[model samples]
Target: MGRGYLTKEMKILVTGGAGFIGSSFVRCFMEKRQNPVVTLDSLTYAGNMANLEAVLGLPRHTFVKGDICDPSAVDFAMKGVGAVVHFAAETHVDRSIDDSGIFLRTNVVGTGVLLDAARRHNVKKFVHVSTDEVYGAVLEGYSTEGGHLHPNSPYSASKAASDLLALSYHATYGLPVVVTRCSNNFGPYQFPEKLIPLFISNALEDKPLPVYGDGLYVRDWIYVDDHSRAVDRVLWDGRAGEVYNIGGTKDKANLEITDFILNKLGKPASLKKHVQDRPGHDRRYAMDSSKIEKELGWRAECNFEEALAQTIEWYRSNQGWWRTIKSGEYRNYYEKFFAGRLAGSSAGSVN
Candidate 1:
């Protein structure tokens, strides 16, 4: 790991820090380094403040309610911030399919806003947190840092645009920008809309667990803690104008994941329902993370099975947390995305 130059103030601005992965990174930053942390979040439907409750009210942590695409908001959040770790964006693919405009505005334009602010502020380091989906579906092996991006959906294409934009800042204006793309991240505090949490939550309630298409869609899984740690390492030690892949190398099919969750919950496998696949659903995704492992010495310390059980336990114990989320706009999402798809299915109507 590169020994980063110590700045006078260890303040880092984290965009989208109230979201799932963002919140996890914030927690890791606080507990690991105890540095002054400023989080900028739009508090969108998926952005819940309770995710950061553990770190709330601490002097080292401050939350700025704002949008990343708003120049004034970003400029205000970047004040006195030595570094910017960007995580703000619309991530849900189904939502992106329904509306690509938001993805473009938030992921690409918002990234440009952060880059311009970081450059104007002369921030020491800028790490852009991205996803492996930007690589699209990889049939076999893995996608390295140099792999060509072939994003298939609005969600991934927008993220790819942001990744390129962040790097361009390094090339054109000499911003010390580093990009880290990781595989699917799962752990506590993840919004229930995602795969693991959604399945776990639905299985708990006897709701139909909708598996898209054949349910064989493959995705590489990484525990959220390892991703957060790797992002920290990248922000501090990674070279400018470089991209790193952070992956746990744990790949599983959608059907396999659903079965694992249902079995773990002692639920019937009959709960699994095959729904119409979304448009442009990638066939498979895998990631190669040798760069971060070799350079930053980061690896997954959490066992997949153990961590998954812990995740299920989290949703079980925190019923109120997910229940509240599901009771509101999330229900509308289910109706909008899955309700119509499951119209003729044998499984009864879903919430």
Candidate 2:
């Protein structure tokens, strides 16, 4: 929470700064670090300006509407920026299965464009926000930063491709690039389509809780704020051209998570409904974050249970915010974005 490491004059450009995790980073940088931040977001379905309302009038903050794949826009944003935090991507797994073209275009091609701009401008650092999904499913042990990438879905594959592209620039052009792959993050302002938020929203409305398959798949849950803090650490002291794994060290099965949500919402257990599991669903995922902890002295400080409760409370208090997002018009947006796509037909499959 201390601002000992960041300088007040540091200027940073954050792509995808209006989305869930990106928005959290923007808020943290503006309020906690007191650094000058310029945010670029394409205003996709998931990106909302309402998330940044708190810092809208701050002099040190600026927001631009642009695409990361456009060299001109990337170049314009990179000028005089000390660092680049790349978070722009097509991130939904189900949507990736439906249509991978956008995923490839934005996640892969967009990263290349940003890297080129950063290299040309000689930015001090380029931090790429990634996901543990790049490592695919973990049958047994946890995956470390050195683990081989075996991305299973179009979304993960796109991210893996971007990670490689960023590192390639670092290796070939000596660009200061660093990558951080984090576990599942849940917190306030998350879009309702994601698992945690979707379930929370439905449960609050007394709707059926959709459980894919038997709901045995497992994943590590990290509070969004804690993940944001880890990002700050990597930006400050993390080694260049290195990959760091950030995890909460808390693993929960999908069924357990569903039960927790039901209990938190005071919903009946009978609301749980079994549905057909998506094809090639990864069985489990875990992360070994010792590298970051030992090297950068970073660890997740938020308690998962408490954070989950707080998130539920946030949704309860902010019903109007999500109600507008769940209207019939939003359903039309979903259909247009993912029309004529099968659940399991994609170029990438989990290993």
Per-prediction TM-score to the true structure, in the order listed: 0.92, 0.91
Candidate 2 lDDT tens digits, 104-130: 999999999999888887788889999
State the C-alpha lDDT per candidate.
0.86, 0.86
After superposing candidate 1 on the true structure, give the runs of residues whose Cα lies further than 4 Å from its correct spot: 1-8, 329-351
TM-score of 1: 0.92
Best by TM-score: 1
Model 1 clash pairs are none
Candidate 2 regions exceeding 4 Å error are: 1-7, 328-351
C-alpha lDDT of residue 73 in model 2 = 73
